[model samples]
Target: MPKRYSPQVRAEAVRLALEHVEAHGSAYAAARAIGPMVGVHYETLWMWTKQALSERAWRAQRGQSGVATPPAG
Candidate 1:
């Protein structure tokens, strides 16, 4: 079976990946660095990072524009 991570773990991983984005030059690179420490695969971490950022942007824009956004999936 695949390993399962809790919501808090996922959120922390995403936050860590974002903090390192500038230093690492991209989400993928940040994930590569943070993944081992957080016990996640680089690719998985990168995807989570991307999703978090996308949702944040979507919400920010929705607040400003007062428009409904479509589901990311």
Candidate 2:
């Protein structure tokens, strides 16, 4: 059975993964390095990191164009 994680835990894992990716320039490497420490599968952590980064990029783009982001569901 898959274990459930709290939102705080998920957010922290994403943050760590993103930091690792920024430092290493590779999501795969970031996941491999941080996943075990955080008790998440590398692939799962990578997906979370990717989604967070993508959302940030979208927000930045909208900000540059002076548009507001729709509230996330």
Candidate 3:
């Protein structure tokens, strides 16, 4: 795997990117706005923001009794 931004820097970049998207309503646009602040390409910034949002959503509903896990095939 390619060495990219530090984890802490990536996380902060993601947070900032999310805020930008939430305010501006577009991930690409947000990435463009945020790319310079952090040393990441717009595509990487967008991917990081998406990954962070997905993780947060997953964590918010983790371990709920009513949620079913699919059986391994």
Candidate 4:
């Protein structure tokens, strides 16, 4: 079975991954670097980051702040 992570953990991982992306190269790299430290799989973290970032961009196009709840999967 897949492991279940809390919303707070998802958010933090997404946040860290984004920061890592800004400082580094790609989201994959961010995930690879941050996942182990946060106890999440790299692929999982990357997906969460991608989703959050896409949502953020979608919200930005409408002039809204990014405060979306990560979707449950």
Candidates sorted on lDDT, descending: 1, 4, 2, 3
Cα RMSD of predicted structure 3: 4.1
> Candidate 4 clashing pairs?
none
**What is the Å distance of residue 69 in model 3 from its true position?**
5.5
Shift in Å, residue 24, candidate 2? 1.7
Which portions of model 2 show Cα errors greater than 4 Å?
A: 68-73
Each prediction's TM-score versus the true structure: 0.88, 0.82, 0.70, 0.81
Candidate 1 lDDT by residue in tens digits, 1-73? 8788899989899999999999999989999999999999888999899888788888899999999875476
Give lDDT tens digits, candidate 4, residues 1-73. Answer: 9999999999899999999997778988999999999999999999998888787676775565555554444
What is the lDDT of every predicted structure here? 0.90, 0.84, 0.77, 0.86
- Give per-residue lDDT, candidate 2, residue 60: 89
Q: Residue-wise lDDT of candidate 2 within 5-71, one digit each (tens)? A: 8899899998888878978778878988998999998888887777787788888888899887753
lDDT at 63, model 4: 62
How far is 33's C-alpha from truth in model 1 (Å)?
0.7
Which of the numbered candidates is closest to the native, going by highest TM-score?
A: 1
Off by over 4 Å in 4: 64-73
Against the correct fold, how does model 1 do in TM-score? 0.88
Candidate 4 lDDT trough over 10 residues, lowest sum: 64-73
